[model samples]
Target: MNTVEWSDALLLDYEPMDTVHREFVDLLAAAQNASDAALPQTWAAVVAHTVRHFGHEDEWMQRTGFASADNHIMQHRVVLNLLREGLAMAQAGQMDPVREMAGELAAWFAKHTQTLDAALALHMRREPPPVATVHRPRGGRGAHASPG
Candidate 1:
């Protein structure tokens, strides 16, 4: 199982998204590193953070009309559901699966960040290039630069 840590590579270059993602990384790491007695509490925090994090992105995608909004949001739904299932497994004394999920989640997040989140961040930060306007002479006829 691979353990992912917060690094510059994970930064999306967008502060709002980065802030939420940073919290996610911190919370997930806490859960992954928690003691057996503390696992449930820590894991619950992870679930909570994920719900808010994904919801935040969903709103951004909808508001900004991201080209892949449907696909991106669907991925979030799938992962969120999986995380919720992990929570239930933890409640049922299935710490191993929850632990396993932490590693898998970390791995998933790394790739998702690079692809989806990176693109979203770029889109959010993109600015339209300046357009130059050509002014026509008062008359409809084109002005002759030089008389024949």
Candidate 2:
């Protein structure tokens, strides 16, 4: 089973944002190591969650008028498309692709969170905290966390 652990280093200095990101990591680990019995649904949820998480981040960046928003959105699109293809494979009963995809995503996100995401987080931290309410909205990749 894939194991996911969280540390303060992953924190982007924004509590709500970090919470979602940590959950994303946890899902990545869980989806990677999950048994065949849980593979299909779990894989779908991971894909969905990632898409939504990207959306959330994009919305935040747009609202804040972050200069790097375009680059960030492009990265998100590419990753999500890759994930969607992986999910499609999993749904077609090819589990191996899921393993490979999950590993790649984990590595990518780890480096991404530590760098780009962290930079954005640090910038947000310097600004006054916004009054944004975060809730899991409908039509997203379904995954569960103990709420960060």
Number of the predicted model whose TM-score against the real structure is largest: 1
CA displacement after TM-score superposition, residue 142 of candidate 2 (Å): 40
| Superposed model 1: Cα runs more than 4 Å off | 127-148
On residues 16-36, what C-alpha lDDT tens digit does candidate 2 reach at each position? 689899889778777877897
The collision pairs in model 1 are: none
Question: CA lDDT of each candidate?
Answer: 0.88, 0.80
Worst 10-residue stretch by lDDT in candidate 1? 139-148
Off by over 4 Å in 2: 1-4, 131-148
> What is the per-residue lDDT of model 1 for residues 1-148, given as tens digits with 9 covering 90 to 100?
7786999999888888899888999999899898877888898899999898999889888877889989999999999999999888888888999999999999999999999999988988884433677776667666555465
What TM-score does each of the candidates earn? 0.83, 0.80
